[model samples]
Structure formats: structure tokens, C-alpha cells
Target: MPTDDLGGRGERIAAAYLTHQGLRVLDRNWRCRDGEVDIVAREGSALVFCEVKTRRATGFGHPVEAVTPAKQRRLRVLAQRWLAAHDEHAPDLRFDVVGVLVRQSGPAEVTHLRGAFT
Candidate 1:
């Protein structure tokens, strides 16, 4: 699959999984001047900002491993900007990672790591 196709599929899987877990989706592919969030949802009283990483194999590494500290920092900044744009009021928030691994001969798998980092 093309890179974009793979990314879209991963995001779709992540959204579905979150919904199945009882989270209400607020947005998909939310962007601002700062950065973009792959999936946004409300889990009970908290708002979730999710980053999705997809891989065809682990030759490089697990998909979640790609969300480095720098990436986390960026996510934080983006989330802050997102909140600012909505209102000065901040909601309970958390960062999450959704790892989607697809294999040509096997079923795809999704791993959701909530509060993976601050």
C-alpha cells in the first residue's frame, strides 16, 4: 500500500478502536499553525490527543517507538495550541499512541497506549 493509504488505514483503525472503547471522537487530522493531531477524542472527562504510527514490519522497530521525546514535545505544544484555539479553558487531557502493524500474510494489529507519556 502507498504511504498515504497506510497512514489513512492506521488512523481509521485507531479511531474505530477508540470508539469501541467508548471514547467519543471529536476530530480527525486536526491541524493548526503549530502542528497536527492524528485523532482527537473525549474519554470520559478527559480529552485525548492521539498520535498514530503504522508499520508493515518491525525491521525498523515497533511503531510506537517512533514517538520520541522530541515528538512528544511537539505533541504537547500542538495540544496546547489546540486548546488555545478552542478557548482559554483547558480540559482534562492525555496523550496517547496508537500503533498499527500490518503484515502481508497476517491480520493487522492495533495497540493503544494511553498516557504513554506526560
Candidate 2:
């Protein structure tokens, strides 16, 4: 599959997993002048901002390792933008990451890191 297709598949899998884990997804692929937020959801009283990364193999690194510090900073700004654009508010805010490993064969493996960053 192409890179975009792989990413889309990972996002779909991540969203499904989040739903199964009992989160109420509010947004997906939210974009602004700055950048895009992969997923946003509500888990109880906290609002979650998520980044999803997918890989066919670990040749480079683990998928979660893709969320670099610079990316985290950008995500924080995007979260603020997202909140400002919406009326929704939460008692807590969190940054979460969902990493999907899709091998050439077998089922895809998913790893969710809640509160992965401040």
C-alpha cells in the first residue's frame, strides 16, 4: 500500500480501537493553518488529543518513536487551536499516541500510549 493509504488504515484502526476502549471520538484529521491533529476524543472528564503513527516494519524505529519533541510542541499548539474553535472544554487535557504496526501478513498490532505527553 502507499504511504497515505497506510496512514489512513492506521487511523481507522486507531479510531476503532479507541471506540472499543470506551472513548467518544469528537474529531479526526482536524486541520488548521498550522497542521493536522490525527484524532481528538473524550475519555470521561478529560479531552484527549491523539497522534497516530503506522509502520509496516520497524526498519527505522517503533511507530510511537515518530512523535518527536517538535511534533509534541506542534500538537500542543494545534490542541489550543482546536479548543478555541470549539465550545467544548474539559477539566483535564491529555496527549495520547496510537501506534499501529501492520505487517505484510498477520493481524495488525496496536499500541496506545495514554498521557504520553503533557
Candidate with top lDDT is 2
**In terms of TM-score, how similar is model 2 to the real structure?**
0.99
Q: Across residues 20-62, which tens digit of lDDT does each residue of candidate 1 receive?
A: 9999888899898878999888887898899999999999999
Alpha-carbon lDDT of model 1: 0.90
Query: How does residue 117 of candidate 1 score in lDDT?
Result: 94
Give lDDT for model 2. 0.98
RMSD of 1: 1.6
Model 2 ranges with Cα > 4 A deviation: none
Q: Relative to the true structure, how large is the alpha-carbon lDDT of every model?
A: 0.90, 0.98
Taking every candidate in turn, the Cα RMSD to the unseen true structure, in Å, is 1.6, 0.5
Clashes counted in candidate 1 amount to: 0
Worst 10 residues of 2 by lDDT: 102-111
| Per-residue lDDT of model 2, residues 40-93, tens digit only | 999999999999999999999999999999999999999999999999999999
